[model samples]
Target chain A: MLNPPEHQVAGHDARLGGLGPLADGSGRFFKPLQSCSRGDNELSFYTSFSSDPRVPPSVRRRFFPSFHGTQLLPASDSSGPKPHLVLQDLTSQFTRPSIIDFKIGSRTWPPSSPSDYIDKCFKKDRETTSLTLGFRVSGLQIHESGDAYYKPSRDEIRSYGHDDVRRIVRRFVSDSGLASAVYGGSDGILAQLLELKSWFEDQTIYHFYSASVMVMYDKEGVENGRSGPAVKLVDFAHVVEGDGVIDHNFLGGLCSLIKFVSEVLTDPDGEGEGRRMKAKKGGTENGK
Target chain B: MLNPPEHQVAGHDARLGGLGPLADGSGRFFKPLQSCSRGDNELSFYTSFSSDPRVPPSVRRRFFPSFHGTQLLPASDSSGPKPHLVLQDLTSQFTRPSIIDFKIGSRTWPPSSPSDYIDKCFKKDRETTSLTLGFRVSGLQIHESGDAYYKPSRDEIRSYGHDDVRRIVRRFVSDSGLASAVYGGSDGILAQLLELKSWFEDQTIYHFYSASVMVMYDKEGVENGRSGPAVKLVDFAHVVEGDGVIDHNFLGGLCSLIKFVSEVLTDPDGEGEGRRMKAKKGGTENGK
Candidate 1:
C-alpha cells in the first residue's frame, strides 16, 4: 500500500453481482472494521499491513487483503471525536451468505461432513489422487481484559458433529494438475502466514499496543472453487508507538494469539502440534 | 560483531593498574559465556553495534561495549564442546567498585545514599542547577525454560547496607555544564537505548531467542570522573535467525523487563512512577 501506486479500483467479484445487493462485487470479503476486532489492534493492523516494508508484496496481497485504504463515516452521537474506522466493507452486508459472527473470543470447530469433499480431503493415508486444499478458517478474537485470555472456557470439544459445511463453503478439486497450477502448497502458505506473524513481532519493538487477531476468509469465492481462501488479519488500533513505547498491560497477548493460530493451522486434529512441527523438518519453507 | 571487522583489542581502562591476580586488567568484564546466554545474540549485538550503518559511532563504542570477538575454549572435562565469548569485560572486575549483579531477574532498588551526592542527585525539586547524568542500569535475565516469567520475589527492600565496596565506584557530579558536554541530555541517552532495543526487536524477526539486558560500567575510571558511565546491553544467546522462527514459549519477557527498567529508571523513588511518566513535558528524548 505504501510502495506501489494504489490500484485505481478494488478488484471486484462480478460473479457476486445479481446474487444480491451485498454482492455489489468488491474484491472478495468486506468485513465491518468495527465488528472485525475487539476495538484494540484495529488501526495498527491496517497501518502495519498497509505500510511496513518488511511485509513482502505477495504476503500483502495473497495472504492478506489489499488494504483499499480507510474512510471515516460521521459519528452517530456526534459528540465524541471518533467515527472510528470504516475499512473497505468485506462483509456479507447486502446479502446474508450463511455467516457466523462468532461469539467474540471463541474457536469454531472444524467442519465434519459425509460429503465426498471431506472424504477426499481428510483421508488419513496420503493418497495424492485428490491433492486437495483445506483452507482452515479460524482466528483469535480474544482480548486480554484482566484474566480473560483467549481460550475456550470449559467447553469440551468433539469431532463427531456431522455437518455438510464442507459442501457449503470449502472447494474440492479432483484434478491435481489444475490445482497445483492455480495454488501453492500448504507449506508455502504456512510460511507466508508465519512471515506475516514475524513481521508483526518486529513492529512490537516500538511497542504496537493492542492484542487481538482478526483472521478473515472469503467463503463466497472458496465455495465456488474460483480461488483458495486466505486467512488475513484485520482491525487493529490503540497503537501509540515510536515515542511512548508502552503496552498498558502485558504485551504477550499478541504472542499467545499468533502461536495458537500456528498450532491450530499445523495440527487441526486432537493434538499433533509437536508432530506437525517435526514433519516440516527440511526447513521446507526456507527458499520460498 | 557480524558486519564490521572485530576490534583487535577491547577498549581498556588505564586506571586499573597492577591490581593483582583478580584484576586481569582486561577490557573491563569477563563474563562466563555459558552463563551469558545461548550465544547467538551475543555476536549480533556486537556485530550490529560494531557495523550497522544506522548505529552512531558514539553509541557503537560508548553506549555498547566493543566486541573483542569469540573464542573456542577447551572444555574442562575435555569431552564436551565450549565456545567462550570474549566480551570487552566492562564490569568493575579489576577494582572492586560497588556494584549490584541484581540476582539475574530481580529489580533492585536504587542505592539510597545518605551521602551528599545522593542529596544533590536525588533532590525531588527541579533543581535547575545540576543537569546531572544518570546512567540507567537494568535488564531481563529469564532463560526460556518452559513459560517461566520475569519478576522479583517477595523479599522486602532496604536502603542501608555495609561492605568494603569501593565508594569511588559511583560518581554523582552536580555540575550541569560538564554533564551536558560529556554526555548528551538524559533524553538523548534514552532515545539511543530505545533505538538499541528496537534493533534487538528487528533481529527477532528471524527468531533470536533469549532476551535480556546487560549494562556495565567502570569502577576505577568513574572514580577519577573522566566520563559518565556508559550503559551497554550484554550477555544474550540462543539466537538462530533467518527462517527458524518459533517462540520456544511466551516472548513478552523482554518487553516486560525493558518496560519495567524504563519505569524504574524514570521513577527511582518507589511509587512516583505514575507521576514521573507524566512529567516529560517536552519531547526531550525523542526525534533521534
Candidate 2:
C-alpha cells in the first residue's frame, strides 16, 4: 500500500494534496509525475544521467538515487491514475533517520526562464537566505538518541538567518552532548559532498538549477558507528544543460555549504567570528 | 512579425490553433512550448544533444537542426505570450522547397509508454505504411519548376498505401521531364541517411521513439546544382535514453527505410517487383 513519506522534510506532501511523493513499504519512493514541464524535465534528467559515462560510477552510486523507471498509480487526490517516477527510498533502511534538505545554488531560475518564473524565483530567493548564503536549509528533522525529535515548521525554517542556520547545523551534528559520527571521519557527509564538489568543478555537462543536496543519517546506526551518513543529490525539474560551461553558481553555493559544515566541525560553539557571506542582489548571473 | 511557416509540410500549425509552431521572418522556427511532458522532453533532447561529444560534429551539423535556445512569444490563439523553443528553420533559404516528413521506426511507441498512447500509436502505424514498410510519409509537398505545386492533404497522406507512398516519393524527386539531382549524388538524401545509419549501428546514446527523418530539397536549387538535398532527424518528444544498449527497434526500421530508398534509386519505376516488407504485429519489442 502507498503511504505518505514519513521522512520527507521538504517539498510537497501528499497528505495535504494529490501532487506529492508517496512511499511504498518495499524500499521504493514514488514521486507523482507533474502534468507540466517540471515533470518532463526531471524525468529527462534521470533518464539521461542514469547511463551517462561522464558521471563516475562511484559518484552515481553514492550521490544519486537509483532510478527504477516509472509506473502508473491511483492519484491521492482521486483526480485520476497518473504516472510516477519510481526511485529508491533514501530513508528506507533507517530506524530513526535525521534528515535535512538543502536547496543549493544562489539563483534557482535560469536566464532563459520566462519573465514571470524568473520573478517568482527572484522573490523567493531574496525572501529566504538563498540569495545571501548560496544555499538554504529548506527543512530538517533531527532525531535524538532518545524518543525526542526536532522537526522545524515551514515558517520557522523560512525565518532562519545566517546565525540561526549555523546553530541548527551544530545541533544536527550534536547527539547526547557529543558530536555524531555522521558528519566527521574519512567517509562522512563532508567527504561525500567534497567528492561531489570535485565532480562539479570539472563537469561542463549540466547546470543543475533549483536542485537539492539531501543529507541523512540514522541516529541509532550512527551511535553504533554502522551506517554513518548518506549524501545524495535530488530535484532536477529546473536543471539546464551547461553547454560546455562550468556551473559556477552551483559550485559557489556548494563551497559556501562546505565552509559552514567545516566550521561546525572545527568550531562547535559560536565563539569564533566567522566571515559572513555577503547578501547579493539579482540572480545567479550577478552572483557569479 | 510571427507568421505561419510556408514550407512546413507536416506537424502542428499555429494558424490552425494556439498550440503549434510559428515561423519568425528572420530564419528561425519557434515551436511553442507545450504545457506538458512532450515539450519538456523535446527541449531536454535538444539541450543535451547540442553539446554531447558522443554525437560526432559531422552528424550533429548535417543531420540535426541548429538550436538557438528559447524565447517568449505572443500566442497565436491569444492565450497570452508563452515560451517557445527557437530552432533554425530547415527550409529558410529555399525559394521553391520540396519536403517530405517520414515517421521512422516500425513501432512508433516505446514499450514503457502508457497503454493508451501505445494503442494510439499502434492503430496509426497499422493504418499507415509504417507497420509494413518501417516508415510512413507523414506529409509531403512537391514543388515543380515555375509555379506548379503538389501538396497532399492530411486525409490523402493518411490513406497512402505502400505503392502510393512509392509513387509520391518518385514524384517528389521528378521535376518536369528529368529526375531531380536531389537523391542520387554523394551529398544527397541517400548518403545522409546512410551516415545516420552508420551512427545508429553502434550508438547507445538514445532511443528515438516516434522521431521523424525529414527530407527536403529546393526544386530551383536542384536545377542549378547550387544546393543539394537536406536530410535531418526531427521530432524528439518521445526520445528515451538507450541505457548503454543499441536501439534495435529504430535500427531495424532505419535499415528497412534504407532498403526502400535504395530500391527507388535503383528502380524508379514500379515495374521491377520489389520485396515487400512483412507487416510486424505488436510494439517495438515485437518489431525488433
Candidate 3:
C-alpha cells in the first residue's frame, strides 16, 4: 500500500527556528519556495524563469509549469519575510487521485558522480526511445536514518546499463498499473523517459534543487486511447540562477539518482527482483 | 556597533526537511504570524483582534493598528497555503528611522512575577513621568561583551522596592539625554516608567508573544511642549485571544524585565551618577 505519512511529517532545518507551525497535517500539497541552499532567493529566480521573457518560448513550453502569482508569507520564527510561488497542482488534472513525491537530485538517494550517469541515460533514452519511468515513493528515504542520514551517497556512484534501466522501470510501472501498451511499448517508454530526463537535465543546467519529478496519469480503470501520462517538475525552492553553462553538481546528482534506480531494476537471472526483495527484507528486518 | 548576523541564518526543526531556502538574508522585518503557540492560527486571531467588531471602538482605536487587508501566501515547505495580514509599517511614519526590538518577557533581564511590578509601575507614573524605552536588539543586557547567555535569578523574583524602580529609569533616561524637567523631575521618570510597564502588561494579559513595546517620539532637536513620547505594541505573531483576563506567565515575564532594569538603575549614594557608571561598569566586567 502506498503510505500516507501524517501530513505533519514535513522536514525542517534547525539552522532556522522550529517549523512546527509550518506543517499542519492536512494533505494540502502547498510547497513553499525558499532560498537556494547556496543562499539565493529562489522566489525571484523561479518566478522569473517560469515567466521570464528572455527565455525562448520553446524552452519555456517544453518545461516550466504555468507561473502562478507570488505573495509574501510570514516566516515561521524569523523577523523577516519570504515569497512563495504558486503552480498548477497536478492532482487537480489527474483522473486517478493517487500522487507520489519523487525528488530529483536528492541526498536521500544513493549519490554518484552526477554527469557520468546523465550522459549514459541520454545515450539510451534519446528522442526515439520515449520511455516513461515512475519512481516508488516508498524507496525514496528522505528522513535521517542513523548516522548515514539522507544525503546523497557520493562515493558509490556508477552508471547503469539498459537491462538495469528496464528492470527499474518495470517495478515502477507495477505500482503505477499503467500498461506498457499505454507507453507505446518498450521503444516508446524509453523515448519518453529520455525526454523526461532531458527536461530534468535542462532544469539542472538552470540549477533546480530538491525538485519533484511527478508522473500524473489517468488513474481511471480505462484510460481509453490516451497518449500516456504527463511528468512535470515542481518544488523549486532550491533553484539557482547560474552564470556557467552547466551546473556539474546538478548533473552529477541527477545522474546518480537515475543510475541507482537503473541498477535496482537490473539482474539477468531475475536476481534484480531478488535483490529488490532482499533490500526490502533487510529494511524491514532492521525494524525500519 | 550594532552587529548584523548573516541574513541567511534560517531556522529549522528537522522533525519538520531542509529549511535551506527559508532563511534568506534580506533586511526586511517580516515576522510570520503562526497559529498561536497554543494552536490558534494567529493570522486569523490577530487580524480578527485588530478588526473584531465586538471590541469597543474606543479601545480598538487606542490599541489596534489600522487594518489593511489579508492575502494567502505560498507555503515555503508545505503543500498548502497560509494567510498573511498586512498592516501599516511604522517606519514610514517616523522622520528618523532608528528602531529597537525588545521582547516583552525575556531572559536577558532579571525575572519577576508579572503583576506585582505592573501595579508598582502604574502607582508611580500618573504623569510628569516621560520615559522612552527601546528594547535592546538582544536582551535588555544592552551590553556587547562575552558570550554569556541571560537568565533571570528565579529566587530573587519578587517585586522591586520603589528605590529600585527609580534607579532603572534613571539609567535609561541618561542614555536618552532627556532633561529632568522633561520628565517632570526625578520622580516623574519613575511614574512614566511604571506607566510604560503597565501598557506592556496589558499586552501580555491579552496573550501576545514576541510583542515589542516601542516608544515613538519627535526625533527633531526641540519639542514645543509635547506631553510625552508614544509607546505602542508591535510584532503580533504570537498573539492569542483572551477572555479579558491577565495571562500570569506573560505578566511574570514582563514584570521580571521591568524589575531587572529597575535593579540595574538603583543607587542610594546620590552617586546616582556613580550608580549609572557602576551598572555600565558591572555589565562590561561580567563580559555580558
Candidate 4:
C-alpha cells in the first residue's frame, strides 16, 4: 500500500488534499504521472538518461534517483487507476530527514510551451525570488534536534527574497545552534554541490527547465555520525534535448546556487555589506 | 537501433538465428519478453527485488544489474512488436570481454510444474553437471589475452563431466599461460562470490530456481589493470516467494558452486584424490 511521504517537503502534497507522490514503505517512491505530454516527456527523459553512455557513471549515480519502471496504481484522489513512475526514495535511509528543495534556473518555461503556460510561469518566476536570485527555495523542513522541527508554509516559501532564502539556508545548517555537520567536510553537501556543478559545467546532453535540486540529510544520523548528506536532481517534466549546445541557463543558475552554499560554508556568521546590497536590489524587484 | 550483442556468450542468440537479447550499443541489454506467465513472473521478481528493504544495498548494487524499466520494441523474429526488459549491459565497459554463464541450482523445475515440463527439466538436469555439481555452465567465451578466443559448442558443453568442467574453469583463469588477474585479489571474483554467498546464506525473501550467475571481465582491461571482474545474478523467470522460510534449494546450490570455485583458487595445480573419487561417483551417475 502507498502512503503520503512524510519526508517530502516540496511539490504537490496529497496530505493537503491533492494528487501527489506516494511512498511504498520499502524504499520506493511513486510519483503520479502528470498530463500525457508532460508525463511522456519526463518518462522519456529518464528512459534515455539511464542508457546515455555520454553520462559519466559517477555523475549519474550521485546526482539522479534510480528509475525502476512505472506501475498502474489506484489514484490517491479515488479517480480510478493512474500510471506512476517508480523511483528510489531518497529519504528512505534517513530517520529524521532535513530536506530542502531548490527550483533550479531563473526561467521555468521553455519557448515551445503554450503562451498561456509561459505567461503563468513567467508571472510566478517574477513574483518569487527566481527572477532575481536565479533559484528559489520551493520548500524545506529543518529538523533542528530531538522532536523539534521547522517547516515553512508554501506562501512563506513563495514570498522569500534573496535575504530570506539565505537566512533559510543558514537555519537549515544551524543544527541546534552548533556547527552544522552536513555542509563542511570533504564529502559534505558543499562538496557534492560542487561536483554536480562540475558536471553541469561540461554536460550538453539535456536542458532542464523547472527542475529541482533536492538536498537532504538526517539530523539524527549526522549527529550520531552514522550517515552523510545527499544531493539529487528531481522534477524533470520540463527537460529537453540540448541538441549539442551547452545548457548555459542551467549552468548559470547552478553556479549561482553553488555560490550561496559556498558563502554559507565559508562565512557562517558574517553578513557582509555586499550581500545586503545585492539582497536589497533583489528584494526591490520582488516587491514590484 | 538495437543490434545483437557482440559479447553475448550464452542463452538464445538472435545472431545464431533465434529471438534472443539485443544490445543498444550504449549500455543497455534488451531481452525479449517470453510467454505471458513466465515474462510476468520475471518482471515481478525484478520489480519487487529492487525495492525489497530486506535485500541489502551492497547486494543489490553488486550482484544484480540495475533495471531501467521495460520498452516495447520490434521483435527480432519479425513477429510484430514485443516488450523487452531493459537492463544494464554487464560487458559494456570492456573492450574484449570474457563472459561465463552458470545456470544455478540442481532442480530446475518446481514441484507445481506440469509432468511433461518436470520430465524435460529433470532429464536435462541429470544429463548436464547440474545434478552432480548443483550448477552447470550454460555457456562461456574466454578471450585468451589477444585476438584468440575459446568458445565451446553446446553439444561439447552438454557432454562435459566433472573433470571437464574443472578443466574449463582452469582455462578461463589461465589468461594466456599466466596467473589470472581477475579472480584472486581482495575485490576479485572470488571475493565477490564469497560476498554473494554471505547474502544467500541469510536471505529468505525469495527462492530462485533455474536462475543464472554471469561472471564477466575484460581480458584487455584486466591485463592493463583498468577494470576488474563483475558477477551478476540473472534470469528470474522461475523465482518464487520464500514466505519467511529460508531458500534451502538455492542456498545449497550456491554453497556447492562456491566450493568448486574455492578449490580452483586454493589448489590451482593439485588435483586431490578425494576430488577424483567424487568425480568418478558423479560420472557414474551421469552415465546411468
Q: Is the docking of candidate 2 incorrect, acceptable, medium or high quality?
A: incorrect
Task: Please give the ranking of all candidate structures by DockQ, highest first, separated by commas.
Answer: 1, 2, 4, 3
How close is every model to the real structure, measured as TM-score? 0.34, 0.48, 0.31, 0.48
Cα lDDT of model 4 by residue, B188-229, tens digit: 787898798667645657878899988878766777878888
* Clash numbers, per candidate: 24, 0, 56, 0
Which digits, one per residue and each the tens of the lDDT, describe model 3 over residues B242-265? Answer: 332233333333343443334334
Stretches of candidate 2 off by over 4 Å are A176-180, A273-288, B1-288
On the 0 to 100 scale, the lDDT of residue B199 in model 2 is 84
Candidate 4, B42: how far from true, in Å? Answer: 68
- Among all candidates shown, the one with the greatest DockQ: 1
> Per-residue CA lDDT of candidate 1, range A79-116, in tens?
32332433444432212121211111111111222346
Which of candidates 1 and 3 reaches a greater DockQ? 1
Q: A270, model 4: CA deviation in Å? A: 2.8
Candidate 3: stretches off by over 4 Å = A1-40, A52-59, A72-83, A106-171, A179-190, A199-205, A256-271, A275-288, B1-288
**Please, what are the lDDT tens digits per residue for candidate 1 over residues B153-222?**
2221111111100111111111111222222345433344455544433332333222333432233344
In angstroms, give how far residue A93 of model 1 lies from its true place: 5.2
Candidate 1 runs further than 4 Å off: A1-211, A215-288, B1-23, B26-28, B32-65, B69-84, B91-189, B205-211, B216-229, B237-254, B257-288
